[model samples]
Target: MLKKSDYRVVRALGHGSFGSVFQITEIASGKQLVWKRMTIVNDEDRKMALSEAEILQNNKSDYLVEYYGQFEDESEFYILMEYCEKGDLRKYINHLRELKAITSEDMLLDIFAQLTEAIFSLHSANIIHRDLKPENVFMTDNFIIKLGDLGMARVIMGTQQHLSRIGGTIQYFPPELLIQIEESEIAKTDLRPQEPVIQTKQCDMFSLGVIIYELITLKHPFADQNGEVLRTNIIKCKPNPLPNNTPESLKQLIMQLLCKDPTQRPSIQKNKKEKHQKKNKIKNQKKKNKKEKNQKKNKKEKHQKNKKEKHQKKNKKEKNKKNKKEKQQKKNKVKNQQKKNNNEKHQKKNKKEKHQKLNKEEKNQKKNKKEKHQKKNQKEKQQKKKNNKGKHQKKNKKEKQQKNKKEKHQKKKKKEKNQKNKNGKQQKKNKVKNQKKNNNKEKHQKKEEEEEKKEDEKKEEEEKKEKKKDHKDKKEDKDKKEDKDKKDKHHKEKGKDESSEEDKKGQVQHDKNKEKKEHHKEKDGKGEEKKEEKDKDEHHKDKKKEEKKKDKKHEDDKDKGKKDHHKKEEDKKDHHKKDEDKKDHHKKEEGEKKVETEKKEDKKEDKKEDKKEHHKKDEEKKEEEKKKDHSKKEEEKKDEKKKDHKDKKEDKKEEEKKDHSKKDEKKDHKDKKDKDEKKEEGEKKDDKKDHHKKDEKKEKEDKKGKKKEKGDDSDKGEEKSPNVVQAQDIKGDA
Candidate 1:
């Protein structure tokens, strides 16, 4: 019933019908706890869980494990209990095997007593521990027993004799239940009467019997090859044979608890609890007796301790006095020894000083005698040096003359040898110089040939450039001619419009002259009747003539603007042509400068060749007299180097040939590129021209559209003009 979230799970201890048992820590208090988790998936499970929790919560005994709390969640319920440091009885029983199995009987009886007591308490509370096994019995670090895992426990009515339901581990099953299981299997086959088997308190005692035997012997009481064989043995009511060394009392207790008949099996009434009480009583008696004996021993130890203390104190006091006296005597002796040592040291130092003074005087006398001896030795050495100096000077003069004669003889011999070999050396030097000069000439000739080839290549390249330029220029010229033709055609069309305009002007003038003549006649007849009407008519005709003159002036202004625009365009084209021609002239100048630079470079190379030839001749003359490291191997290496150079030169020539071919291809590409560029430029120019022409046409169209609108407005204005004529007529009437 514990809240699972309230504890941090340390590790899982085990899992069974109730989900699992975990060693955990309570979060709030840092208390270690055990969680028995059981999922309450349905009301029946919930009810069973509540019953188990109730049985745990209501029960209280040192022999029975304590329940701390419980809680339920949506999916599961948890029962929190005291955490047993030592895990369970089964593990401890297994450990008994290593500790000597025979030593386990006493421990087993104690644990068995506790288990039986816990079961008695459960039975008294109308609860049956259906699954009593060694694993369900927990132990503490102090070897305290705790009965746990009441998950299979059931509550019974007060008058109920036993539980008729099946539960518990097979190995721990009582003989009665084994027989019942066998009977149930037979009943299923309709081979026997169907009798309900019930779990009484004897079942738990039987389990305790098994736990006891297992702890003492380190195995199950009815152990076989497997649970099934054990089950068959259990159904036959065949119990495990006890060893001969097993205590009679302990063996008898286990045998009686595991009796095949529940009626014959001893309940908690007179078995474990009574034995526990008797054991406790004996233990109390033993403790009392031990305490009495301990008290007597303490009194005797105290007297002995006091006597030893007094003797030690007497010895320490006398020893202290003796040590004091000894220390004084020793100190006095040390002082006397120090006085004696000081005296001796003083005597030794005085004698040493006296001896040192005597030695100094003796040393002084020896020094004077040595000085006299040294002075005499110095005079003798000076006399000897004077004698040896004369001998040394005469010997050096003879040796100097001998060396000079030898040097002169060697110089003459060298001069004669030089004279004898001079012609041969000169001939060899000339030959070496000639060879060097020939090598230089060959190198210079090859350089000149290469330079000539480079010049030829340059000429070819320049020719190709010129051809491409010419081709592009031709295409540009053609495009320009086509544009010129288009412009001329437009001009011819404009001329026709001008002639038509002249005819329209002539017709307008003739109409105006006729109107003037009519008006003059009207003026001539103004003296007659209806004079106002005549004046109105003449005024209207003059107004019409003025309107015609205004429209004609607008048309003439538009034509003048068009002509000025065309002239500006022609000037721009001429300026573009001049720019292109200037670019061509600059390019030609650059090409000529490049050619001149090539000639200058060739002349410089020739001068370098002449200097190198002179240098080579001088070097060869010097090299002929010097030892050179040239050998046949060196000659072979040089030949290899020459071949490599030749191969490189051939590769370079091939590459240059390919480059020349590529250059031809590139020139063709450049011609195409130039033609493309020229065409694009021409097209761009044409587009600009066409755009301008379109704009002009658009403007003309806009004008014509405006003229149409104007014509309509003119009709309106003309209609209104009649009103002006009427006004004039009105004036005439006035």
Candidate 2:
């Protein structure tokens, strides 16, 4: 029987209106097969497909088809059967049409016989295959005809039923089915079944007649496409007549099948004997094929099973040998590990003991050596102190002797300085006495010079009176000469009053000559007056020169006195510098003597420091011994724990492990807080330090400024003091 799962699809065979057919392989035998899958979309369609599957399942005709199984799913119904390489009768007709092959009557008879057998089987089962066309009439690759696809086949068991349903290819539908369809449609709207649609198994016979017509004439019996034309043609029972070359007997059979009258239409030709023989032969042949295929499969399966069993046995033995060798190797490894562990533990124990003993011996030896060294150092310190005392006494005696000698020398130098001061005071008094005498002499000389100037002035006045008398006489002479010249010019002009133009010009020229002579006489009188004034100025300038000489002599005397005073002061300063230099030399000798004493003290201190360092070294040596003991004990215990132990290592690591991230988080938080605090504190401290430093700097600058001021004042001496004290006087002067 056909089933959805029974065949795997290979390729599409063909398709029709409602569903498609595919060439598939039967799953069980891997043989090529075909499945007629109808798309059954509703309950009615499913019911119809289910009924068809049942009908095909009930059929016992080899000539009908090889119905393997029937299957169905949500959307489709499938009927699995043998694959016909040549396809169905419709395809064969088309193939023949394409080739224009002349089909024989015998081939038609053969198909008719196969179809008759198929219909006979369906009828025996009380089923009517309402739709029968060339497409439904399939053939095998071997040219074996098979009638299949009972999708429209109906159950008509008891009476000739009235079916108003209309489905199937319209071109293949007989006239009777079309007529019933019309009546059924009419009956539906009219709401009556009074005149029943008389449908029966004979409708299938009519469809068969249509297929026969197509095979013979290469055309549909109705000679119209699937439309109203085909329906009307089918209803009118107007099929084209048979061809001229058609066997009359087959034609008559076809005519009988297509008769318009249902009662007149022929039933499917049935031959029980031939069907039995064919059925039996088909059954035996299938049994033989099945038996041969099973034998080949069983033989191949047995061979594979034997091979698998041998492989499994060989693997089991090898696995067992491998397991034994691995077990031995593991035993040896464990034993070696145990031995190594024991040896390591023993070695660690010995090492710990050796280290402890060695540390103790070294500590005792160091203590003994330190005690002996300390005693020796103490004796040396005592001897050094005695020797230092002797040297100190000797140095004190020498210092006292040097001090006496320095004192005597200082007293002698003081006597000489006092004597020098007395002499300098006597010299200053004598110089002052002489300057007073010189100033008195200058006063007397200036008095005498002033008296002489008065005498010279009296003498000059007398000389001026004599000169003035001479000048008066010269002026009188000049006055007389001028009067004479003017009278002469008056006479000349009076005489020329009546003269001619040339005579008048000669009179003017003579008057000009008289005027020139008077002007020369007047100039000579002025020259004599100027000479008298020049003689008076010469007497005044001579007195001025005498006064300038007296002033220069006084300034020269004052400058000489200032120079003498400066030279005396310079001599006193040089004597003082010499005395200071002698005192500095004595001080340097004392400082050198003090440095020698300090060097002796530093040597004693160095010896004391060495003793202290030696004692500290002894103490450090003792500490090292203690630490070594502690470390050795710790190592011994640690090694014991490590020896022959794997679990302890993990346990210790887990115990020692800490959440570093949490620690880091805490540390970071602490660090941040510390940094903030430090930054704040540092800022405050830095501020304080900066202020303190600034104050210190100011104090230092003040001290430096004061020192610089003092030094500058000393360098300028009374120069600055005079400027400051006399500032009021300077401002008044400005």
Candidate 3:
């Protein structure tokens, strides 16, 4: 009979020899439960079920499944438990198909932690679940694992005695269980006993080790076969080494767990506790080391950055100082040049005044000499008449001479006044000339400075234009290369079609023949282009050279013009010297009145020699300036040649780089072709091998069918099931 109101049986989930588990719903609250039903007609089985229910109901832990209730019907007892939606660890293992999913180390560690907690809870409760396998471990949707089946579990202090019958699933049973029983009696009794032959904790540890090994390798450590084969292997064989993919730490732990003797297996709780302590220590140490490393790295980077900044600041200061010094020097030079120019203008003015004064003085001296001679002659005539004639006639002659003398004196006064006026006007004109010359020199200096600035701007503009042109040319070349690469890739992809591939192969052969011809054509084109560019460059260079020559010629003309101007100045200076000598002679004549004029003339002759010496000094200065300008021009020409040589070297380097790039492109194309060919060959070989294997399998199957047909009844009697054959083959192989 089934209960109608209290509990509702839903559907069977799974069944084993001892019990059947069902997904059930409570009638009162509609709560789901995994109902484990066991037929417990025997008193001992009933006691065991009741005991298990009591143990489950008493113990409450997140790591263990909760027991809801226990109830009995007419024939069977039902134990309701918490339903785990994700089923059990066996399903998880099967889903992943491996012990560890790739890149799921954290998930594995979490599983280990939960499993350990579950086992620890069972141990603390003084109960031992003798069977702990992947199938007995339940997992929730959140991946929480709980040890589930407790059919083989025993309470340490229970009134019931230990059973001689074996209990646990064979695959996970410890070695002691198998060894304790005789080989012949193994089939007659259970393989596991109710009471563990060894320490219950140690036995559980062995089971945990098997679980860990399975978790790591996705396969049981001793799973060599099925049925009796697996049982035999478990009894006789040592576990294989941990898989290559397992972490070294995890593998070592598994190896220790897989030890043959139960005593040799490490305690699970102790290992877990120790690992926890070690992990905490390592985490603390890592944090401390990271802090120290960061501090040291920061200090080093800061020091280097500071040093760099300091260096930059120092360089900037020095550069500023240098620029200021240069500016000051230029200012001083300009001032000195201005001063020199002013001095030259002043000297020219002084020389002009001196020459004008000399001419005026010489004219005055001649006029005075004539007047004195005329007066003397008139006086001589008066004396002669006074001696020969009477007193009245002498008186009349004296009156006439007095009137003529008065007229001559008036005329000489008028001539002196005119000469004074002329000298004053000449002095004013010389002053004006000096002022205008100073203004002209200042304007000329300003014009020269402006011209220099304009030249520098023009040079910068030309350089910018050249840079822009080079950039444009590079852009064009890059675009062309990109286009060529795209074309090549498209052609290669298209050429993979069989028909197109054949055509392409033929074309390639033709292309190889045409390559030499095309290469020659390209070479010719390149050569012609290079030659044209070279000619253009040479033409530009020649134009520059011509410009330089023109500049030099202009400089030479300027020098010649300066020399002519200097010669004119020298001639002017010589004239001034001559005038000064004449004036000196006139002064000496006036001072030495009675002394001979011959002395004055002799002094003038000596002054002429001095004038010639001054002229020679002026010529020497002009020659020195010419030499300096010529040397400066030579230096500029040499610098230009050096620049041209550097530019030529740069051009050669650029051309070499272009050649290297072209070669790289060709190599890359060849590499791509080779890779495609190799891939094609590999695919063909793989297909052929697969086809051959299919043919062999087909022949074998056909032969087997033919043999079966020859003795149908006999074959049926003797033949094994296909499943049995496969199982046997697996057993044999294992």
**Residue pairs in candidate 2 whose N, alpha carbon or C atoms collide under 3 angstroms:** 1-68, 1-69, 1-70, 2-69, 2-70, 2-71, 2-80
**True-structure lDDT of candidate 1:** 0.67
Quantify how close model 3 is to the true structure by its C-alpha RMSD in Å: 64.7
TM-score against truth, every candidate: 0.36, 0.38, 0.36
User: Model 1: residues >4 Å from true position, as ranges?
Assistant: 1-4, 98-100, 182-196, 225-228, 270-734
Worst 10 residues of 1 by lDDT: 184-193
- Sorted on TM-score, best first, the list reads 2, 3, 1
lDDT of 1 by residue, 44-80 (tens): 8888888778888899876677788888777888888
Candidate 2, residues 584-623, lDDT tens digits: the string is 7656755886898899899879978986996797679658
**Model 2, residue 303: what's the lDDT?**
75
Q: What is the lDDT of residue 485 in candidate 2?
A: 75
